[model samples]
Target: MIDPHHAPTGTAYATAPSIVQEICLIAEASGSGPSDVSGDREFRLRKAALLDCIAVQERARYGVAASADADDAAEVAAEWLVEYDVAHSGLSRKGRDLVLAEEYRDYVRAEYEAWSRSQAV
Candidate 1:
């Protein structure tokens, strides 16, 4: 799991806005209730999913585990947010933007799980 507090030196990738944008788009399109992007579960799960998707889509996009990785992960997370169409999209009070971030976390988790499963085989 990528530490929210501690990012890689000289590679601290920050793109929370991208996820915010996706969340807004989703809410705009679906017209549903607020999204469930918050707390530990949401962040961890969605962040994982985002990472996995980025890796599958393209490793080079992340560069390392710093700038590129964070950026790609953010993009994937934002994508999920937009895709989910969670209402009240921009409801993150702490500026963390949990709503959009959660989806990406889920994506990254799924990616690792699949990879782990394959390795077990």
Candidate 2:
């Protein structure tokens, strides 16, 4: 069992998609599967990440609907990421949790940034 929880700090940041994929794979291998079921928080975060990606792809295509969906998705993604970090880290305080989550958050931010930049070009 590769303990994802034991993954080093910043690794999550550098590998958002990989992390997401691993989670999905684990969820699947667990017999329940990601699509079969997940906790509220996990589902919400997954949806947010999905929507956020859709919005970015749409924006790259210059779609008018991208802005609104993207904003909403981004907001939700951040919210879920925070929740996820808190849940996973089990820190005694917000400060410590935030510190732990920062790398992952930055990774998400970078994904969006790269997507946005590509759209510009």
Candidate 3:
């Protein structure tokens, strides 16, 4: 229930392609030639997952009432994203990605809901 209006816009998240680009670079360096079909597919999937997580986090952080504690929400969301990145950094070819997992999204939603309730009280 994030307030779309309160969500930060035009920030680095909007223009930062470095995250996915770095992943692609790594794939290429790992002996999966630049044109490797599997590598390309993995890159696309990873990119989508990363963006989805960002969107989810942003909504969870900003969707709450404006009166809620913004600082606390922001901190929690930031921490979550960092941990998510670390967790997915070593994904194997056949390993399910965090972004594609319903459990991870649910976890974020649950955390946000808890934080929002705490702030409301």
The lDDT per prediction is 0.43, 0.47, 0.42
What TM-score, computed on C-alpha atoms, does each candidate reach?
0.25, 0.38, 0.26
- What's model 3's lDDT at 81? 44
RMSD of each: 12.8, 11.7, 14.3
In candidate 2, stretches whose alpha carbon ends up further than 4 angstroms from where it belongs are: 1-46, 63-66, 91-121
**With candidate 1 superimposed using the best TM-score fit, by how many Å does residue 49's alpha carbon deviate from the native?**
1.2
The better-scoring model by TM-score among 1 and 2 is 2
lDDT of 2 at 61: 58
Deviating ranges (above 4 Å) for candidate 1: 1-31, 40-44, 60-121
Q: Which parts of model 3 are misplaced by more than 4 Å?
A: 1-39, 64-121
User: Which of 1 and 3 is the better model by TM-score?
Assistant: 3
Q: Could you give candidate 2's per-residue lDDT for residues 11-88 as a string of tens digits?
A: 223333544574575456446644443344445444444444444445555665646656565556655655664677
RMSD of 3: 14.3
* Cα distance off (Å), candidate 3, residue 113: 23
lDDT of 3 at 49: 35
Most accurate candidate by TM-score: 2
